[model samples]
Target: MNYQTFQPHPDLEALIKCYWTLEVPAEPAATKQRILPDGCIEMIFILGDDVKRYTSGEEYILQPRAMLLGQISEPFFVEPTGVVSSFAIRFYPYSFANFTTTPVKDLANRETPIRLLFEEKLAADLEHAIVNAADTQERIRIMDDFFLQRLKEEIVIDSILKSTIDTLLSAGGSATTSSLLKGEVSKRRQLERKFSKQVGLSPKQLGRIIRLQTALKILLNQPDESLTSIAYESQYYDQSHFIKDFREFTGVNPKEFYGNDELALSSLIYT
Candidate 1:
């Protein structure tokens, strides 16, 4: 398995978190890999072979070769159907809204092909460019060129949505939405509506996912960190609360996750 991440171009730094790629050699036996939410959105291109995303034990679907995955609220399962090689763009929670008008909430937990999001011809051309590129850097140039074009359109991102996500991310999801704003009960409701349309999840839900990402990063990097210490660092109320939230997002306890073979993809990507 090989995983690497690249910084975004200077001009796109505010909207994009980073670009990433993963390559895993083909194996003799297939294994289901668990994927957890990280409080962001991604545009993925499968450059090697198809991958299967399971909806249940007995059912699954092939992920689109070039597609967008929106804010994920729960853990999901996926396995490689062949050699796994993919390149993707990770966007900050509220920034993808600048690219299209598609209600982000509608894309939750699933992917939509790029063609569906852009004109068929334009999407096809972009995919063609990436597929025909000689290497990863070339691929990045292709992707960057495409987004740079979209950037010129000058889409408006809602101010409340931007500052709210900034607070959630900066605080590692520790701050409450109410505290981020002034007195007014209805203000929270209004923010939720914009968040759903623009960021794909309520402010509270996005916060939880971001918090889990924080804890997951600690576990992945510092193997010696105790669960209790992780909980405190992530600002969970208690170990129980931390365990409950971890289980909710990852479908497993921290102990099971530490050395689990099934988490190879998760560990490699998050680490």
Candidate 2:
């Protein structure tokens, strides 16, 4: 397996987190890999063989070749049908809304083909460019051109939404929503509505995902640390709370997650 991430063009740094690529050889026997939510949206292009995303016990669906993967509230599993090659753009929770009018909430928990989000011709051209690009660098240039064209339209991101996400990120997701609104009940309701339309996940859910990411990095970097210590460092209420959130988003306890083969892909992204 090979995974790498590249920084986005400086002009797009505020909205795009990074561009990433993954390549893996086909394995005769493959286990379902669990994907955890990381409080962001992604535009993905599958450049190799197909992959399956399980919808339920023993049920699955083929992910779109070019699609937008929205904010996921829970963990899901995917398995490759053959060699895996993919290129993707990770968008910050509040940034994806700047490019499309589709209500972000409508995209949650599923994959929507690019055609559904953008005009068919535009989506097809983007996918063709991605698939035919000579290499990763070429792909990056293609993406930069595509997004930069849209960025020129100068879509204005809502100030309230941006500030809320900024506060959540700066605090490592420990900031309370009420505190962000300064105990203003009306503002809290308005924020919730905007978060649904623009960020998909409610502020509270996004916060938990952000916090989980911090804990995951600690676990990956400090393998010897106890769960209690990690919980303290991550600002969870206690060890049990940390374990519960871990299980909720990762589908396994911390002990099981460590050294687990199925988590290699996820570990690479977080590490």
Candidate 3:
């Protein structure tokens, strides 16, 4: 398996976290890999063979070429179809809304073809450009140009939603929905409606996930730190609360997560 990440342009830095490419040579035997959530959404372009996503015991389709994977709230399994190579962009929670008109809330826990949200021709062209780029530099250039063009063509960011996101991000996921909306539940609901339309997850859900991500980063980087200390630092109520949230997102406790080598790559990608 080979994986690498590329930095995004300054204009897209706030919206996009990083662009990445993954390549795995065909194995003598078939294998399945489990993918866990890290609180973000991704736009993926499959350059080689297809991959199957399994939810429970059933298989979910990840069509060849390109797709948009919504905010995954839980873990899933991926079975590679022979040799696999792919390019993907990881977007901040609210960033993807800047480019598409599809109700992001409707895309959760599933992968949909890019054409469902973007024009079929444009999506195909973008996938081809990303996969067939001459080099890493060219791939980065293509991504930046595509996003910039999309931004210019249709940038309809709602101010209240943007402000709410700003608060959540600024607080490092510590801000509550009430705090964000200045204690107005009605306004909070209104914001959530708009957020659901574009960003998918509600403010509260996003905050919780963001908080989980913060704790994960700390645990991965400072393995020596105690769960109690991490809980306090991450602003959870206590160790029990921290453990509960961690288990909710990762299906494992903090201690086990720290010791899992297979999850190391996932932790790095997410953080």
Candidate 4:
């Protein structure tokens, strides 16, 4: 397996984490891989064979050549179809709402074709460009061009929502909704309604995820640091609270996670 990631354009840096590509050679035997939630959404274009996401023994559906996986709230299994090649854009939880009218929160635990959320022509063209790209560099360039163009075509974002997200992210989720809203309680409520309608998750949920992100980075970077210190730095109420939230998001305690080989790839991504 080979995986590579690239930085997004400056204009998109606030919302987009990175663009990535993955390639795996065909295997003689079938294998399954588990994907854990990381509080982000992704738009994926399959460049080679298909991929299947399973929820236990049942298969959901073979992802189309190009699809957007909404925010995943739970762990899931994926089976690559023979040799697999794919490129994806990882969007910050709030960043995805900037592009489409489709409610992202509604997409939890779902992978749907991009056409469902975007115009058919744009989605088709983007998929074609990705699948035909000569190499990872070319793929990255194509995606950059595509995102820049599509961004220009999107509807104007709500100023309230934009400011709210900016405040939450800047505060590292330590700020309360009331403080973030300040003199706009009604507007804040309206924003949460819109967030749920458009982003598929409430503002509080995204904030929790963002907070977890910060905690993970600290834990990974300062392996020798005590959990109590990490909890305080991460703004959790206490060590127990920190551990509970960490386990909720990652399905493992910090100590166990540090030693899990299967989690190594995911740890690298999040940390």
Best prediction by lDDT: 2
RMSD of each: 1.2, 1.1, 2.4, 2.8
Q: Mind giving the per-residue lDDT tens digits that candidate 4 earns over 198-254? A: 567777777787787788889888999999999999998999988998788777887
The estimated TM-scores of all candidates read 0.96, 0.97, 0.88, 0.84
The Cα error of candidate 2 at residue 108, in Å, is 0.4
Cα lDDT computed for each candidate against the true fold: 0.89, 0.92, 0.80, 0.78
Model 1, 1-271: lDDT tens digits are: 8899998878888889999999889998978899889988999999988999999886999999999998888888998988999999999998898898787888899999999998899999999988888999998888888888888978676877788889888999988877877566678878888888888888888888889889999999998998999999999998999999989989999999977877888998888
Better of 2 and 4 by lDDT: 2
Residue 89 lDDT in candidate 4: 91
Candidate 2, residues 1-271, lDDT tens digits: the string is 7999998889999889999999999999877888999999999999999999999999999999999999998987999999999999999999999899899899999999999999899999999999999999999999998889999986777887898899999888988988889789678888999999899989999999999999999999999999999999999999999999999999899999877888988987777
Rank by TM-score (best first): 2, 1, 3, 4
Query: Candidates ranked by lDDT, best first?
Result: 2, 1, 3, 4
Q: How big is the positional error of residue 82 in model 2, measured in Å on the Cα after superposition?
A: 0.8
Name the runs in model 1 displaced over 4 angstroms.
none
Instruction: Summarize candidate 3's per-residue lDDT along 1-271 as a digit string, tens digits.
Output: 7799888999888789899888878877755565776557898888778788766666566654688889877766677778888888999777787888777888888888887787879877877787788876798899899899888887766777777877887777889888888878778668888878877887878888888878888988888899999999998999999999888888788888864654645665655
lDDT of 1 at 28: 83
Model 2 clash number? 0
